[model samples]
Target: MRKMHVWDENNLIDISEVDRNKVINPMLVFSIKRDGTKKCRLVARGDQQDLSTYSKDRQQDTINNMALMTVLAVALDHNLIIKQLDISSAYLYADLKEEIYIRAPPHIKQKDKVLRLNKSLYGLKQSGANWQKTIKDYLKGKCELEEMRFWPCVFTKGKFLEIIVCLFVDDIVIAGNNVNTINQFITDLQNRFDTRIVNDGSPNERDAVRYDILGIDVEYKKGVSMKFGMLESLTKKLPLLGVEFKKESRYNIVPGTPNRSLNQDLDIPCDKDYNAKVNWIQRAIGLSNYVAMKYRFDIAYYTNILAQHQLYPSDAVLFETERLLQYLWTTRGKRLVWKRNEKETSELIGLTDASHAKGLKYKSQAGYFCIWNGKKLFARSTRTSYVCESSTQSETYAASECLAISRSINYLLSTLTGKKPDQILLTDNTALINSIKGTKTINLDPDIMI
Candidate 1:
């Protein structure tokens, strides 16, 4: 805090002078790094701020998962050099737009005084927006990089867009075909902000092929393939789920079992112990969903099902959640691999399906998988919003949803790679196919019409 001059300690004012409502509490967040280094950050309780005092649109945008996956695929396809960097105390660099006072930390001797913030602090509502604008201006104005229209957090440079920089708040991934060019940009970025290149303990940081970005372990094999996994994250979460393994314990072959009946016992009295168990189940489902969304597509359906019962999970649901965690522990090493297809075609392939009336309340389950040049770009398994009368209607609804998502991804790939890929939406329903080909007319809701 002293180094950054986050607040004016010398200018501390009496607490009675400022509005008591503006005074916020200070928070200290502590964490350990992978390299065994401990770090602490001082933040403000932004939630306590008066809603009328600040704007509601303070949330900042970052690179979405689909865009991140597409960038990875592009890096692998072009054999680009990928490097990661992080800006230390990123939010502290941005100046505060509004006057906000925070109570002094415990270490300070001034118990009756408050510190006026000179800059943005962590946990502030506008801190993320401020930091985002700061970096966006630096990248666009200073670095002369053009921000991609589809993804604002992504920037490109060069005549043919040789360099691509993806920003996830403080963490940055720079990919380019030229090593010296990327390094030069890194140097420029470091000079402007306090930056550190993410080093994976490699002999040369510039030539690092393994990286941990956004909690996903990414390993690149030049032009061969790229693999993404969450082994360390999942391993850490397993113990939190109260899962233990015996030496001779057998593992589950699948994350969940189909056609399993759930205990619909909502009449059970809600006690403290029951509420605790419900919270535990919710946390477990949250972790499982995170893993499934990031790289574990196989468990998406299971996690989706488990999430529905979070409000009032029974012993059966709890058991299934634990079983899923055990399955994850057994297959922790599994990774989502993206291999370079031998073919030089730029195509976006989509596969979508739905099971009618499979979920509770007779709701259908819809899923879709999108592929780009043999890489699994995106996948989603979600329960349908409304119940459908027939399997054909459910399948059609799923295909429509899939088409919308696939087209958006197709746009991202085309803009990044400079090639318009043909999109093929595949479905097992012949009636839907015939409807698309004008051979048959299948009645669909106006909103689901293709």
Candidate 2:
């Protein structure tokens, strides 16, 4: 905060301090890394933002997951070192454009004086957008890094060897072919912002510590691979759903069964306890969906099914939620392994499928999973809102959704790889494929179009 001039106590405004400027108590959250390392950090309780109105566009700053995956794939292909860097008090690094005030922290001796913020502070809605703009300006204007066209959060610089930097809010992951280039980038970051180079231990060392970023614990093996997992996090998270796995419990080999009754369109009678367990069921599905989205794609389809019934959950959904927890417990040890394959190709493959009118409301369920050079890039499944007249239309709708996601992924890969690789989309419906190629005609009903 001192480095950024976040506040000036002496600066006073004529207006009286309002309740909107009130601050909440900060707390510390602790977690264990996948490598059995302990981590802890203090975070402000920023939930008081409803007190003020935010009209600014706040979604355009960060890079998407597909962009991050592209950089990771590029790094893996080039045998480059990937290092994570953190900006200290990232929000405070930018000056606030609006004249805002925040209550002084409890530890300060001056209790009555309100802090007139000179820079952005935590709990302010605009802080993230402001800090992101600040970082972008510094990198592009001062450091001379060129931002990618589609992925604004990704920057590239070249001295002797090209260095690629991917940003996720305040956390940065950098990879380059030359060690000196990587070091110089870090030095530049440190010169501009108070930065900490995390997980700096020698990759070849067995005792080297891994780092945690966005709920995934990442470990790099110098020349071989990068392994990531949410094992330690899931260990602590699943118990909150009232799920406790015993050694005697039978483990399922797959995430969900082929004839998974959870996804079947069955109108199970809502028992008296359904309303009571509604919150618990929603919480479980939310936690499971997070795990699925970030770390495990295997459970994506299963979790999506659970999320559809969140508003009106039944006994069966609750039962399936428990089953999902058991599945998580069984596969907690599984990690997303990105290994160095000499023959690895920059291949973009998309697999999409849909269950026609399988939903209780007769809506088709659609899902797609994508991969880049054997690494899972993105996956999503959803029950379509529109009711389809035929199976081909359902498949077409599913394929279109998959195509949208794949386009973004392809754009990222094209920018990073400098060559747009062929995006091969696989689907089980031959008529849908033929319809896409204009070789077959399929009628689109008015309801389907809607």
Best-matching candidate per TM-score = 1
Question: Whole-model lDDT, candidate 2?
Answer: 0.71
What TM-score do all the candidates reach, one by one? Answer: 0.93, 0.84
lDDT by residue for model 1 over 1-450, one digit each (tens)?
A: 888889877887999999887788998999998657899988899889876545788779899888888888888888777888999999999988787899988888788899998888998888899999999999988888888886769888874447889999999988877666677788889888999988522423544377888989988877788889988877776787777754344546788767785636645556768888887888888888888888789999889888877776677887888888888888888999988766778778788999998787888989999888888888899889999999988998888788888877877777777887878877899778777766436533222223
Q: Give the TM-score of candidate 1.
A: 0.93
Runs in model 2 deviating more than 4 A are 11-56, 109-112, 159-161, 206-211, 256-276, 438-450
Estimate the lDDT of model 1. Answer: 0.81
- C-alpha lDDT of residue 14 in model 1: 93
User: In order, what lDDT does every prediction score?
Assistant: 0.81, 0.71
TM-score of 2: 0.84
